[model samples]
Target: MKYMKWPVLLGILFIHAVAAAQVPVVTLGPDFAEPGDGWDKLMQLKNGNTFYLHFSRKEGLVVNVYNAGHELTVTDTVHAQLWNTADIESTEIDGIFEINGQPVLFLQQLVKYNPVLYRLVLDGVSGKLVREDKLGELPSVQFRSVFVDDNLASHDFYVEKDPESDYYAVALFSGMPVQKTDSIHERIQVMHFSPRHELLHQGWLYMPDTTYSYFSYINMAVNGKEKVYLGTVGFNTKRNGSEIKPKVIFSALSPDSATFAHQVLDYTAGFANVGGTIQVATSTANVYMLLHVPAKQGEGNSSIILNTFQLSTGKLQKHVQLVFPELARNMEMNLGYKDTYKGTPQRFMLNQDGTSTLLLENFSFFKQGNTQINKLHTNLGDIGIALLDTAGKENTTMAVSKYQVITGICEPFQLQRRSKSEWMFRNKIAALNTNTYLSYDYIPGQSAAFVLFNDYLQYLDTGGQDRVRKPLKYAVDANFVCYRFYNGKMERLFLFGMPEVTKGYACMMGAADYNAAVGTYATLLISRKGLEKKANIAWIKF
Candidate 1:
């Protein structure tokens, strides 16, 4: 309930400094000795043990177990005959989770563009293989990025387990055929698995009909009750050819595959002028959708439309158009001009009492090039927060001031022009309570690019006259800040000064996860050394 300003007080500064000093850095194994491509994943088990998992077809799957003190205790490798195929180059590892006190690794191998999934469970202490089973597969499916979904709308492979029931399911989707010969087709394959990795039920669900000419975006989520929900937004060509009408559809598939329900959300009638992005979020009992609809009659501003659905009965519960007077004021005050609503929902935090927090980033693109060549930048304009209570009413709306610029190259390895430096502000937010959240900002500050290029703009502005732009230098200023939010207000907790990370150590935080059992925050880092890379997990305990 108390507020603290930035440049925090002396007592608050001491608290932050102490927490920063307790951060732990764990290094993985030595560099690769073989000449093959591989990836590593870090996972924490249920029994308070951690493991660094690395696998390559040539070397098989290896597990390096670390104790509570972050010391490596065991190293185990499994070289099964299943990975001896010739098409090993098309193999992909999804993720690692636990089953019956053993670590199970999920892998997908592509055979002629189709996918075959395999599950292998390893012993915790000895790293020996406990069981190896071939799960299911979807033929003729394409794979996308597992780390980041770049497509505006696409399906992702999900492997989830029900904690209470100890049951699991795998959902895989194959895109429609390039040549549309059929109107409706089976597009999704869902497989239910037991705790021992045995396939229980398999079903195929058909996607809604769409023309071959029209492009569609689809996203899916599975609930704890073993139900799969699909939310799709497509633009179909009208008969008069005057304009393309937006269509939105929702589908639900039950666990036994006996009951399938489909509902049309009045795509053409309700959202005749709406078209941007449709993001879907699901709690245990409800499905929520946030649509960035075009506000103006033709093309002036945008509006956020929130729709809630009952997951059990597949019924539309409520639909409300959210108003953001505070966000408009924040944009006008910070950017000196007001733009349309461009909030892209990234994180949806749901509570037990049915309240949800929708965190959005005002996203836009920047073109930085002259008449000759151009590059696109993903500009993070600002941050927006919306809270929806149990009644599906948006009770509060708040916008935070934050601007970020993303470049093409990963700044940890490559260098660009000094004028076009790659600035990064890494942060993470986690729910502290039903109505409060905490965000940690770890900005080891900006660095000037090592290279310079002034020809792109100079050629367009001066008719190819000047080439030199400015001298280049490397610079960095590191610091960290924390913020607490509750009831439509934000308070700066404290800011701590920090030493810069040495070269080859990519201090940029890739991901953050909270360990509920330990009550600590863990940050994942991708550290590179020339051609080799290491996975470092930093634990921040206060």
Candidate 2:
């Protein structure tokens, strides 16, 4: 691969001049004139020849269709009800390969005080209702994210299980209940459905005891062998109070969910009272857990622990602890450094070659009077690339320069390998009062790393030893990057979306190209918007 230098490069200068000549054109469509106060949820769906957008307002939920020319072709009012009663909390569209091989849109309707889970499927072509099925009585469970697997004939569902049940007792509480009833085991249920929506597997995870106190968050992941990794919170009730332990339990299931094997990862045993997130990447067999330790509890400074475990051997490779040194010095740093902290060391980017980069944010403090106020002035996030040597005793650690001061927010968006020595990072940057976000893809292949940011990708070229800014004419929203030689000129292809501004929050943008089949590709955007908000998915075709 040929590595290009940044800044002083003639190619960058030429591109900048071309980008300056191109004006951003914004074409507005017909207004969605629904009498509503706040527009909360928005989802975009693309079929073969059409695009569908579904949005919810204070009034009801509406669906609008558009063509490739950006013209609104069809409008459908899916459902309407009184302001307080009707609510569509979640909507998912899946391209089902079976059953006539059509795409189906599943909308989950939730009444404010009801416990029923309503399911509705919309036809992909006509935008009409194909079928509606009531998914029976559900628990008083809060809404979580949903997933649909096309290759597999089952839909895996996960929800918060009740803590007072016998299943909860065995799986989490670490103690058995005095009295066990039939209803106790039915408190929490994990349901798996067949292709035709038939119940395949439904049962509760056996717990130790039926205690009112248990861990809060529960996340599920399926490994290569189809074993379910249930990352959950476990609690122990002693003479004092309930102590929470963050644990990842692996459960092996047979085809019918009748026979199973279970094991708890002992590496995560000591993690107590920490409430963070866990993600497992099957391709790399790496499990990353973000732990939030409380500072006031004398648990030391709050930090994120990156645990690398092998799926084949079920052994932990390395446990790296990430902590913001500056943030730890501030007395005003509360538990988990929730307030007055920009970002934690939880941001991670896993490379293809088993190497990874971790992004950590630190904060400084200033004394006003009797009270001390911690201010996030500097972003101490550095990219640490770790490579395991054959001896395993000598692990190489390559640290990059610290990033610019990003106030109170930072995230690892995209990490691309430019060359043998260089890597590129496209991070989503945001600050206070500045809603605009940009992408900075750093090319580490060359001597002077070049960072591509926003429309004008800026880079530092060692060839000229100067900084240069150029306009990258490719569309910004799509995940896939295309380069082609047309008429002796390099042409880039991209799909553009509406520009959005972040409000008092930072966002992490991620993009990847997945090959669905031969000559077919899907561009996916896995973006984490707000810290507390859910990660949204946007898929486009090229």
lDDT of 2 at 457: 20
Clash number for every model? 1, 18
For residues 40-66, write the lDDT of model 2, one tens digit per residue: 222233443233333333334454554
**Model 2 clash tally, residue pairs:** 18
Please give the range of 10 consecutive residues that has the lowest summed lDDT in model 1.
Answer: 429-438
In model 2, what lDDT does residue 410 have?
34
- Where does model 1 exceed 4 Å of error? 1-40, 54-62, 77-96, 99-102, 124-129, 136-166, 178-185, 207-217, 233-246, 268-285, 290-304, 327-341, 366-377, 391-497, 500-508, 525-536
> Residue by residue across 1-542, what tens digits does model 1's lDDT show?
11111221112223332221223223343333322234344566667667666545466566777776666688776766564334445666554567777877676776566677777788876677777777666645554421111222233354655433446667665443324453334455667666666666666555343421222334444554566565555333333253444556666778667434666677333343333222224435667655554432233333556667786777777776655545445445433334545565554555556676555655556576452222544444345555567654455554444433443311110111111111121111111010001121221101200000111111111211112322111111112233333332333332122212342332222223344456444443433434555545555443
Q: Weakest 10 consecutive residues, lDDT, candidate 2?
A: 417-426
Every candidate's lDDT:
0.45, 0.32
TM-score of every model versus the real structure: 0.62, 0.48
